[model samples]
Target: MDEIIRAAGALLGQSLRYPVDLGGSSRSTVLRCRTATGGSVIVKAFADDPEARRAYTGETAGLSLGLAGPELLAADIERRLLVMADLGDVPTLADLLLGTDPKAAERGLLEWARGLGRLAACSVQRRAEFAALWQHHGQGLPSWEDEPWQRQNVDAFLDLLTECGLTAPPGLADELTAVGTAGGERYPGFTPGDTCPDNNLITPEGLRLIDFEAAGYQSVFLTAAYCRMPFSSCWCVYQLPADLAQRIEECYQFEVVTQYPDLAEEELWQAGMAQAVVVWTVDTTLRLLRRALPQDGRMHRTRRPVPTRRQVLRHRWTSALQLTGYPAFTSTMRLLLSELAAGWDVPELPGYPAFRAGAGPEAVQTVNSRGPETAGG
Candidate 1:
């Protein structure tokens, strides 16, 4: 700990004090420290390992771009540490959704979508610059763009289906090749990869994203999927009010359409979104299937109203079933539901706590009694 403090203090040329541990995953240690000038800074020291080094590289490159996020104060490659301006004590989107303020949560969700869409639009042309920066910072590691995780997930899930005694659906092809990735050279834009709810801070300045370890550019539909599928890769999963969810999706689409005008076509945009949704659902299932099927677990350790794993996956499969164009993928999701989720003994996923509360902003926009279909992602 002292070594990390010294490294961060050296990089910033200051005496650091009052360090408070901000929770991080196994990959890194995050600290909030007060500078000699009485302001605070965030110091993140990566673990001494290859995966951590790659994460450090991605975050460093993304922050160095200065497109958005906290200002990168300083960095030291040798120590694998970064010092960034602290955004401070702001409520994250997760906080709002978990709290009892539906209006606030709805507003935060829309703002977050708009911010990410605008960021993607503005950074659409920076792929080369990002690649260069990534290369410079990450000499030996692959960027998220070059990672084979997508294809790996596709294969792994097929194996998982076989293990479950379920065969791949025979819709698009016997080989099931159509159920691959939604990515193409078109509509590529920047994303932080893990745009989960907890990582987004809903500050007074607006929505500020954090944790750029998986940062790279990809199809904008992936980002749109997060809004439409509603935090596609997050543990903080629940249903959004139907109207609010549509508004959130529209807010993102409206911003991105400025950069990629073709997305203004409802059919094209919706189709792309459906493809991305299926891709994300497959990736998520591959990762969580073994763990969830054995037994259900809470999505968050301490958060209330959190759904169980089986519930979340069931919700995702249900949403994927509604997607129009992907017959094979839809069939796969249905089989998973009937064969696996049917015996989980869990009810359908419920709406977000804020939106479901009896009082707070309940039904701000009227809709039929049926709320949003549960999200599986």
Candidate 2:
């Protein structure tokens, strides 16, 4: 660690002090350092792992596009280190969500949406440039909403349910396959890939995105949907209220249309919603399965300080069911929700009231009848 810090200081041509370790994934180490001249900067160093190397490379490439993120001050690809301007003590959107102020939380959420929108808008206009960088450096980057990717997601979800001793809803696999196939034609734009609220910092200027290790060109709808429903895979899973989620979706759509005037707004929104329901449902289900199944070394570490594992799993399950209320997938989602409610223990969850199977016409109906509750519930 000291050697790396020394290398960073040498790269900056200055002495440094008070290096603070900022926790990152197992594959990376992040540090906040103060230069001898009293300027603050962030330094990220990747492990020797191949995926980590690719992520580091991708981050460098993505930042070069001049989209939304901290300013890159210096980079040492060979050393697997990147120095960027410090974003200061600004809280993340996740922090705001956990705070007492609902209005500030809402503002942070909007800013997060707008920042993503601006990044997508700006990158779409320079797709060629972003594409070239991705081609060269974006290995292990997610292919969001592509046919193969979607199929893998569906199969994985099915496998997970089966492993958990639960029978998947009839034709659920086929329905998911069809959704994936429909999105085969790639949407054009650059995606930050991982847009978890914690990956975004709320600054005086607005929300600034960070962690572009998974950055690449993909469907703008893929990310738009992701913003709408983050699912369980991320620790930053605080979702906006239904009305606010809708408004934010509209805000993102408006920004996209402003940047690409010829694009169809309704089509984009529909596609985004479709992607959201399918992808988030599958991913969140998979997460629940992992929690139920045996432990793996990779799953041992706990990242987020808030929301116990049970809380997150419960949120994913209920939120996915709530998504079924959408008009397009109502029937299919209702069936899945019924099966899940019957086969799984939803009522015993902490803070969640017991739900009787026949209390309502459908599982989602019951969820809606309960009215809005804190995300923790």
Candidate 3:
């Protein structure tokens, strides 16, 4: 540890004080540190992997826009070390949303919208250099939505919705995909793909955006969709008044309509719903995979237990059956969920046991002993 600190000090040309690990991707280590003069900074150091190095550098350059952050104190391209200003006293938008007051959430949401609007409106004319960097550097990384596991992953997400007693319309995933793909191809604007509440910091000066790792030029509709999911979830989970969430959505829509007059309100709202499904689906898949594959390392660290295949199947079956009498092609997401349920409800998928109303321990034994099979091919 001492040797690593010494090496970093040599590169930074300052007397480094302490390093506080801020947990993040497996590919990199993030540390919050303070200098001798009591100035705080964040240092992001990448693993030896070249791809991680490229991504780190790309974000640093691409995100160097109108907003202020910790100054880049030092950077060594070869060592993959970056030291930047740390804005203290400011809390993440997540923190603000967690407050008990609805007004607080609304204020935070408005601040976030204003900040993003300023960024979206900034001149891309001078940003050509960073734009080019993004185009070249971000080519091969995975799209969060297009992962191979997605087709088989709906059951896990459906379990949570069922547990919460919320039954969505059927065939939701395909509808969401169609919506996003269409808007992605047609909409005009910039999008930062991962704009969850954690990425925003509400400072006294204004809303300051952080983390440009996944940002890029995208459709205005897509951009709005990207921002809404996490912001909405923050409000929902934190118990912020429902009205505040509506207001936040309104503020966001206002910005979008102001900048892109051609946007249709109905289509934008549909796109937002699609975006929400995408986020929820991915989250649910990981939850299920952890349960079915308990030996997998990622599952061990999470806070919640993975849902058994039987439990998920049961939840999805109940939800899909509820949508049975509804008209065809109603809600896109609902339709997709129904379709997935049809596949998942097959008499037997490799790892899934036969569903019985009263069986618990017996079902676990049956599924685990059955081994892995393509549950829905």
Pick the TM-score winner: 1
Task: Return the lDDT, model 3, position 199.
Answer: 62
Better model by lDDT: candidate 2 vs candidate 3: 2
Off by over 4 Å in 3: 1-4, 66-70, 123-127, 135-177, 180-182, 226-240, 264-377
lDDT of 1 by residue, 1-377 (tens): 78888889989998898888776667798888999999999999999788999999989999988887899999988778899999888777877786678788888898999999999999988889999989888848887778746556767777889998998886534323553456545888888767777778888889898889888887888888887778888777888888888998899999999999989999888778877887788777876677787788877654555788888889999988897767787888889999988888998888887877584532222111111122232
TM accuracy, model 3: 0.61
For lDDT, candidate 1 versus 2, the one ahead is 1
Can you rank all candidates by lDDT, best first? Answer: 1, 2, 3
Question: Could you tell me the TM-score of candidate 2?
Answer: 0.77
Cα deviation of 78, candidate 3, in Å: 1.3
Give one digit per residue, the lDDT tens place, for model 2 in 1-377.
78878988888888767988776566788888889988989888888877788778778777877788888888786787878888887677655554545677778777777777777777766766766765555445432322245567777877766765666666676667667633325555676667875667787888788888766766666667755665234654544556877877777777777766644557655755665566666665565546543421121233222344444554555555655324433443454455544444423322111112222221212111211112222
Candidate 3 on 1-377: residue-level lDDT in tens? 35445556777777676877665465676667777677767777767665575556555655554343445566666566667777664566554443334455567777777556545545333346555554444434443323323344455455545554546556654543343433443444444444555567777787766555544554444455434333321111212234544565566666666555555467655644454435443443344433433222221132111223433433332423333222322343354345444444323212211122232332111111211111120
Candidate 1 wrong stretches, greater than 4 Å = 171-176, 359-377
Runs off by more than 4 Å, candidate 2: 135-149, 167-170, 181-186, 230-233, 260-268, 293-305, 308-377
By summed lDDT, the worst window of 10 consecutive residues in model 1 runs over 364-373
TM-score of each: 0.92, 0.77, 0.61
Candidate number with the higher TM-score (1 or 2)? 1
